[model samples]
Target: MGTPKQFLFLELFMQLLRIAFGKNMVCYWDMKSSIGYRYSKFTSNHLIQGSANCSHLVYASAHFDAITFEIHFPQHDPPLPIFKPKTLKQSHPKLKVYLSLGGDDDANDKYDQLKYLHLMEGSEHAQQKFIIRTIKFLKLHQFDGLDLAFPLPRNQPSQQSNIGAFLNDVNRMWGSPTTT
Candidate 1:
């Protein structure tokens, strides 16, 4: 019999194989969605900057499905514009691209200043307009879907409700594509 540590390592390796190939699982990572852009470092210069190490695994893993590039609305532009789909298509043809909105910077003062007045609470028409505009923008760029990353304090009831409404409006506007 092998040493305890060796056996544990072997078991872990087997589990990883099962999860990585044996099962038809799909894993997605929210790359560059929050305060830092560190995750981008590992991807290709086009996909992300620091994503070098995981680039191989991201390509090799049959279980990995899509990459969601988070965009902090009103704070930064979409990073998808810089992404090169050729690399991803070569490795995983089914890999889909999505845009995530309302990350950390969306709550900052700069974001507040630039916030679309139409997206304010209790304005269904305004919310619809915002969603329609986002869909059109993403369609123009060939994005698959939208991932709302709205971050609000747990105790803020009003903000949470408004966010829910916003999501509903977006879903309704985009029709929520089933593929991505």
Candidate 2:
């Protein structure tokens, strides 16, 4: 049997292997475990909650590149409490923590994701709202970046173009010195 440290090392090695050759290593944390980080086994019985956190695996990861906390759709508004940037930075200062923009978290979430994409595609006002809110969310939580995980099954060329435009706006806004 492998010791805990050995298992952790193996996990880290596997993640690095996946990230090799131009791929980025991004981990998904489930929506449910918002409070997992707030407790120890000594403090709460919710220790083994099914969510990923920097505490468990980040240290083992050697290169430590980047990790994104997953699934923040427009429907859910502000979702879970992600790990603080300061905490993750103290461990691996260069490691980037991003907030994932869209992914279906459940059956109902598929509907919400579709709506989210439709709003993004159809309404410039909605797009601006999303960008503003997302910027605020990132700044509030001190996330280093944002990751767009396409929310819908886009069919038309124009649909893809709309998403591209949305991302371009985000990139433009992201590079600016102003926070507001």
- Say which candidate scores most in lDDT: 2
Model 2 spans with C-alpha error above 4 angstroms: 5-81, 106-111, 154-158
Which digits, one per residue and each the tens of the lDDT, describe model 1 over residues 28-48?
Answer: 344443324543333343233
Cα RMSD (angstroms) for every candidate in the order listed: 10.0, 9.2
Cα deviation of 93 in candidate 1 (Å)?
A: 1.5
Task: Predict model 2's lDDT versus the native.
Answer: 0.49
Q: How does each model score on lDDT?
A: 0.44, 0.49
- Backbone clash total for model 2 is 0
Overall local distance difference test of candidate 1: 0.44
**Which residue pairs show collisions in model 1?**
40-49, 40-50, 41-49, 41-50, 41-51, 42-50, 42-51, 42-52, 43-51
Error of 2 at 151 (Å): 2.2
What shift in Å separates residue 39 of candidate 1 from its native position after superposition?
10
